[model samples]
Target: MTAGRSRARGVATAALLGALLSTTAGCGSSPSAESAETDGPKSTWEEPASYSYTLTSSTQVLAGTFRVAVRDGKVTEAVGADEDSRRQAHDLPGEVPTIGTLLQTLDRARSEGADTAEAGYAADGRPVRISLDWDKNSIDDEALYTISSFEPTPG
Candidate 1:
């Protein structure tokens, strides 16, 4: 029984690894701009709705979906990902400094040796950008990923 459980775990891990590999491989090949825009307008802020993007690297892969709402130049709602992804997103704001407070954070992270990073904002004014610096390296090793959505909440 113990051996069977171990095998099952190994299989699950392998599956995840395969998925990650596939995603990274896809990223390796530059995607055509036209292909990337299969749905919605080119600019997310044009309309009030949700947007999602999948980010993947050789080491890890993550999917982030954001629901943004703006009204009268004020941000009404900003929600990202599902429960698990939300947990990851929650750690983002606190870990990295805000764009307003420190604009150079992105550049600095890039210079260090980061693996993945991204920046985004709403058309109104509110901006939410999340960046990940793996191994504390420069942008060369980092991946810049971003998702900008727009939606207005009730007053």
Candidate 2:
């Protein structure tokens, strides 16, 4: 009787395990744009040689909103929209990044196995927001960028 009871309990546990696995199969969430970057068909959007956009950065080092202009793949101008942005624009102009630069940063973060690196794209496949946290356990190694009003300029 004891041997029979043990076999029955083992069978019951196996049945429960099988049922749970079957129920959870194919229940994963859909991949987001950031994860898709690592796989699947590439985005159709390409970075223009000249463009302008509004960038709102929230991070320890850069926290401000700025109107950024990129020409010939370089940041030709950056105007701060607020006091902090203006100060950062005037003092740390090198920190003001273009869309390509931001993309590169995100890529590097992903390569380095950052704790978090996610992005949201516009309908045209342009990145509208990028969130990075190099080390979730550590403080001050995070960056959040919001891009808006992007317009490609003609040469």
Each candidate structure's count of clashing pairs: 19, 0
Write one digit per residue (lDDT tens) for candidate 2, span 30-123: 6454332221123356789999999988665667799999998789999999886899899989899999998888788888888777676765
Off by over 4 Å in 2: 1-44
Error of 2 at 150 (Å): 0.4
Local distance difference test values of all predictions, in order: 0.38, 0.74
* TM-score, per-candidate, Cα-based: 0.32, 0.72
Best by lDDT: 2
lDDT of 1 by residue, 113-137 (tens): 4554334344343333334445542
